[model samples]
Target chain A: MSHRSFVWLCLLPLAAVTVAFFLLPMARLVVTGAEGPQGLAGYLAILTEPRYRATLLNTVLLATATTIVTLIVATVAGMFLQRHRFPGRAILIAMLTFPLAFPGVVVGFMIILLAGRQGLIGDFSNRVLGEKLVFAYSIYGLFLGYLYFSIPRVILTIMAAVQKLDTGLEEAARSLGASPWAVQRDVVLPALAPAFVASGAIAFATAMGAFGTAFTLATNIDVLPMLIYTEFTLAANFSVSAALSVGLGIITWLILALARSFSGSAVAAAG
Target chain B: MSAQAGHGASVRIEACGKTFADGTRALEPATLEIARGETLVLLGPSGCGKTTMLRIIAGLELPDAGGRVLFDGKDMTAVPIERRNVGMVFQSYALFPNMSVSDNIGYGLKIRGVPEKERAARVAELVALTNISGLENRRIDQLSGGQRQRVALARAVAIRPGILLLDEPLTALDAALRDRLRGELNRLLRALGITTIYVTHDQSEAMELGDRVVVMQKGKIAQIGTPREIYFTPNSRFVAEFIGAANIVEAAIENGHLVLPGGRQPIDGDANISAAVAMIRPETIRVLAAESAPLSGVIDSVSFIGDRQRLVVSGVSNRSLTVDAPNTVRAKSGERIGLSISPDAVRLLPPER
Candidate 1:
């Protein structure tokens, strides 16, 4: 076969799988939400309802909070891992990345065991501080669970970026009479800005779309994912569920677009 | 220039050494002095601790043993790199990629809190001094190698540093560009009158640019002198061999004459030792016809160089000697040729200790 045909054959399976499992299902969901007997009324109802609105806002708020926290912690951790070489550096890196290997549900269960009301530190806080530390069923609880998984992903991405940076820039800044703090601010941070933005986007998208952890930890507060799950399984409203899913997808895409725009300038600056 | 001549700081180093944690001795105890407004070139082979010495002077690397780096009669041993006010041009031309050419040159001024208008004027002056005025808006990545080198030089001098350290700054350029820049750099440095220390493995560069050359080997200063002293009258066999291509022949002093395996010649200097290596320059060897030849050898090979022809002659004792003659002298391989050298051209270097 010709080279073009060979490449086409190699990509045929991925194309088939995407069409079969992803595009078809999404198209069907959108069509059903628009052309059903209610015919877009279900989407309107979900959008107009105060409960759904609150749930959407809460989901966005939680995703933003988780993203900022993950970015700050992961960037600092990545800088440490990249710059400082110590005896346990490799072990520390592997431990930070250990969450990526575990399924989201398993991570949720682990977080529950550590921070649930009856759990280890939760129980200790209750007894010692005379306050009940409840993290199982609130937005805060969902964020904690999401953080367990997202922080590691952010760290790995940012760490790779930091490692690839040219150390000569920092030395140049120092040689130019810049203080240590000034070197970090002007040279190192600007160099790492693109990676920071990219990793933040990934963290935010992952936190927003996380269902397994949210489902496992939901109690009184209902995020968008939980509401969609309830609408699909309990209320048997597939159309509404699909609409919520599409909304979440749009939000994530918008965030990713902003990230690309911001990081483009950063990459240019680095070059 | 007058101020520098009268009151500029001179660099004084005493007993400085550096040993890494891995026990690798990068620099042994070294002592030297650099006069104000004099350019000293540190020349050595690779891994000879030249770069390490430059770093120690720049305060980037500290010595492990006892040493004092006195600048302008002030002890600067404990000062950090930033406070030392020493500008360095690294081998890699470590320009900040995020900054434009003008900004890179002005960075030190900005860090020193020079006002914006003055910094801009100084940057413009340096850019013109380095002949890179049109490249002010160019980024480092967008510049050619020579342009980047000029930018680096401009940046180093923009701050008017007390001392300028260059770590093989011209080694990265093409040969043609390197030669051109060498003259330009000499002119610019002479005009600025900055105390500069240039490090390189190229001997010709050291000879051409330095007021004094410090030849190093194995973490020690082998010899330090003027270019003529180091090249023509080396103190030791290592210095002679390292500085230039000199033919070393073992000879003995007997009856007020130097006796070699092939010939006998009168000795010029006092010969206290029994045996020494006769250091002969290729240009000093004269190829004569067989009848009047002092030593006879068969020409192994002859090649035409740009200005002269070089002949590799193998003596009957199997000792090979190189001779440079005018291109007009035609000699072929396997031909018997006579070699003669004047006693004054024969330098007796001390035996390798």
Candidate 2:
């Protein structure tokens, strides 16, 4: 075979996979979104319909909060974890990253086990206050579940970034009359910005599309994934479910794109 | 050497030693005093504790207990680097890659709560002083190696530090750039006059930039003196071999002359010691035709370097002797050449350990 044709032939598997699993499903979903009783306006129900609109807003806010909180907690923990050494450091890092190996259903189960009616915190609060303080099966419970999985993803990225940081920059800042806080603000944080954007986007996208956790402990909360699940399974509304699925994917992808461009300046400056 | 262009703080470090957590001793208990507006260089090979000493002075690494650092007679050892008000430049330059050139230089001022307008003025002044003008808005990666070095210096000096600590600041540049920047850095350091402490392994850098050089070895201070003293009157065999090229000739002093294998070269020693280890600089020996001179050796090899030619002469000592002759002098390999020397040029040194 000629070299040019050989190179083109090498790409055939990737092209076939993309068309079979991605493009075909995506095109069918977009067409199904408009083939409903409401016609093309079915896509607008995600925005104009109060229940669908509330679920979208709820999911967006939860994902954004999860991303912000994950970045803050993981950055501090990751920096400390990467910089210090003591007994049990290896085990501690392993424990922190253990969530990455857990499925979403497992994380949701862990949250329920910690805060459910018979859980340790509820049992302790019942003894102390004469009333059980259970919050499982609620939005708070889902938030906790999302945090458990998101923290590990962001922490690993931040830890790697912190490990690769040029320590000379901190020394230079200190030698130039920067206080510890000033050094973190001027040198450390800016150096870690790209990692924050990259990993936070991943965490945000994951939270937006996470389904198993919502399925496990979701009764009182209204979210995009739970709504789409009910619409497809119980109500047998394939068109609306497909439309919501597209909305979810498009919204998550758009937010990630926005974050990427926001962080592009940081990467350029660091270059 | 004491031009005193800017405010120069007198620094004294006493009994400073560093023992890491892993039980490795980086520096032995050492004491040093740097004068106001003077540039003192710590000269040694890698792992010789010169950088450890500089860090102790800069407050990057604290000295062990009982060690004290004083600035102008006041103890400042407890103060951290930020509050100690010292400026430092590193081999990596360490300029902030996330900020513009002006912002990197002005960061210290901004941290101190200096007004933005005044911060800008100080940054501008330093930019002009370090000769990195018109590059304020440029990103760090956009800069060449030399420009990065200039920005590092400018950033360090923008705070108007009491002392400037530089650790191999020019070691990262190319040879030609290092040579050119050495002259520029020397001029800039002298102009700032901020009691600078420079650490480097290059002997030429030590000789050129240092008003007084501290020669260190294996975690201990070997010798501390003017560059001329260290060269012309090295107290130990290590210093003699470490700094510049030297032909160490071990021979006995008989009747106020050094008796050698080649011939009896002249000596100006008291002859108290029967055997002596001596250092003779290459440029001190003059070469001529073997028939007219007192001592002679065959030229082993001749390397024609610009401005001078270096000749390796055999059969003069146990090892081949390196002799640098003028470029104008005519010499060839395998030729027997007469050697001329003045007795005063020979420096007697302590025996090696």
Best by DockQ: 2
**Residues B1-353, model 2: lDDT tens digits:** 65356466899999999999999999999999998888999999999999999999999899999899999988999999888888899999999999999999998888889999999999989988988899999999999999999999888888888898999998999999999999999998877777899999999999999999999999999999999999998999899999989999888788888887677888885768888888999999998879898778889999999999999999887678899999998998999899988999889887777
DockQ of each: 0.65, 0.84
Model 1 quality (TM-score): 0.92
Candidates in order have lDDT scores of: 0.83, 0.90
What DockQ results for candidate 1? 0.65
Per-residue lDDT of model 2, residues A1-271, tens digit only = 9999999999999999999999999999999999899999999999999999999999999999998999999999999999999899999989989998888889888888999877877999999999998887888889988999999888988999999999999999988888888889989999999999988888898899898888888644798989999999999999999999999989988887788898884221110
Task: Give the worst 10-residue stretch by lDDT in candidate 2 chain B.
Answer: B1-10
Docking class of 1: medium
Tell me the lDDT of model 1 at B254: 82
Worst 10 residues of 1 chain A by lDDT: A262-271
In model 1, the runs with Cα more than 4 Å from the true position are A1-10, A36-50, A264-271, B1-8, B316-318
lDDT per residue as tens, model 1, B27-108? 8999999999888999999999999999888888887758879898898888888888888898899888888999999999
